[model samples]
Target: MAMIELPDDKPVRHPEYVYMDYARHLSGRLRRTITGPMWHGPSLREALDGINAADAVERPIRSMQTIWEIVLHVTARAERARLRMDGLALDEPTPEEDWPRIPIPCTAAAWEYSQAQMATAYRSMAVRVCEVMSSGFLKVVEKQSYNIATMSDGVAEHGAYHAGQIVLLRKEIHSRRPNGAHVTDLLW
Candidate 1:
């Protein structure tokens, strides 16, 4: 079979390479940071594990965001990164888009929907990161401070930051459970 070479796009990960390539490494890091087994602490998914709708909507601290709002914001950021991979000329997300208000009457079904949307968005962003060409990683989008590689790192960092927040909030809510019914078994 004749190997066809594309002039404009060279993949960062070559199948024959014994070691992992740049894009694959970045992709793995991004995935782990968002999804778990991270060395530093709980991943985003782990942080939200077992949280019900009431837990999701609880604001343990005054003026702090609910777990639901953080999930929505993370989803929005992930979606933004995915769209940028397709060369979308998107500007910074508006305040509403960044941290969308939680819907009134947030039911269990609605909370489930938010979680599903967040998972899908993060997965899509990771897929895009894994598919970037070597050159693509170096090419910065106009009006953006980070290149593809750094931007993807930012996604992981952003997720980790929010995950920490969620974990703390979860702890606060758990601590207040009646009759000393704290979540003593929480991994985080």
Candidate 2:
């Protein structure tokens, strides 16, 4: 079969080549930053690994956000990005929405649940990215200036940024403990 020719006179390879390359790059980023093995440092999951509900809600550093709030905030951003990529409408995050409030008495189970929810949200967004790429819908949407690829990169970077914060918070929390235990020791 004759290959498709672009305006630049370059013969197009299989559609899979174009789509798969984009999909793999985006998904790999999501995986590495959110849950997969990290080359640079701990993945998001690792950063939050052993945080109990108490530690998650503790503000050891004055005026800084708790791990619980950060987790929810990150999850919300990932979900919103996925919605945008799906061509769905999304409202701007209100101040209250950006940094979520933890329950009055955050329990271990509640923290665990939030972590699970964040994982699910991240996975959902990654899957949507791959779907968009595989379907060859790579052009910028009419409603937005950036394309799905750009959004994917933003999500990965956003997650990584918050992951670093969680790691720092975990260290601070552990340091405040009498036992001086490491964060990894608390992992379930």
Candidate 3:
């Protein structure tokens, strides 16, 4: 067969609408999948397993959030969203505003407790996604502050972005571990 070389396309048109829908759908699923106990290892526990406690405490790859901080931050965000969605006034201030006020615990037991709380919060957020889908996609609820999102697209993107940070942090931690074996581990 003769090889044919095609010239580059004159210009690529952006499928902005299609891409937006895809982003909305994909983010929804990513949020749901990561919160569940799936075999593909998307759950919070799965993400936490095999990770050293000390390493997980280190700050995120790009953000100031440590893995522990990220867990707490995500949980708080979910809670705030739920409140706003439910027509409740958020007595709790925004994270950036309240972080200094909301003292982070320093003990091991406290860290574990916070992670568990986050897991519960994430599961609740997933349930809310189902509620919204059942009601209708992008149904504007007066309670939702007119700050609406399609099911979970907005929060999901935020979560997934942080999740990637978590994954990178894990790799860095493994590399720095005493064995330094994961520095060369195939799974890494």
Candidate 4:
């Protein structure tokens, strides 16, 4: 593929090359939106960084859910979509699965494990997205009406939405601290 330099002096694949390898282009774009630095703000991984178990489990507002529950919920949604994309015959998520019950004590180990699970689910989703893109078959087998490209984009958007919530919850929790510490101090 030929490279063309734009006005900004950034070389991009030629138009012809892009058209010929549209699937690869789509895969790359989806991957970047999911994990790479986006114009809006931090990606999902960045949003969860440095959050301790106490912070994860704390419900700053009685009506709202904890950061841990939100993370698990996001993970469940993404994993379910990924499974469907992979042609797996998994049952639809129940309300309990959608909002998973956080471990009673919310220990550091459990918090870390939840984080790992979220990361793993996202990674799996990304892999399936690439596979769908590479196969040049955007339409998911399970849902004839929906295409993988659209679904992948939706998943990325979903992650960003949850990430924003996590940020807001972190701020709320930090502001409520007894020592009156700033949330900015807790964030990187």
* Clashes found in each candidate (C-alpha, N, C closer than 3 A): 0, 0, 0, 0
**Runs of candidate 4 exceeding 4 Å displacement:** 2-36, 89-91, 141-144, 183-188
C-alpha lDDT of residue 50 in model 4? 60
Which sections of candidate 2 miss by over 4 Å? 1-16, 134-137, 141-143, 183-188
Over 7-91, each residue of candidate 2 has an lDDT whose tens digit, in order, gives 9998978776777777877888887777767767678898988788888878888878889999999888888888888777566
TM-scores of all candidate predictions against the true structure = 0.84, 0.84, 0.62, 0.76
Pitting candidate 1 against candidate 4, the one with the higher TM-score is 1
What is the alpha-carbon lDDT of model 1 when measured against the actual structure?
Answer: 0.80
User: What local lDDT does model 4 show for residue 72?
Assistant: 90
Q: Considering summed lDDT, which 10 consecutive residues are worst modelled in model 4?
A: 25-34
Residue 74 lDDT (model 1): 91
Output the lDDT of residue 17, model 1. 37
lDDT of each: 0.80, 0.80, 0.57, 0.73
Cα lDDT of model 1 by residue, 77-159, tens digit = 98888888788878999999999988779899999899888888877777787666543766686568778878877888898
**Which parts of model 1 are misplaced by more than 4 Å?**
1-20, 184-186
Q: Evaluate model 1: give its TM-score.
A: 0.84
Q: Write the per-residue lDDT of candidate 4 for residues 39-118, one digit (tens) a residue.
A: 67666667776679999988887887888998898888878878778776556668998899998778999998888888
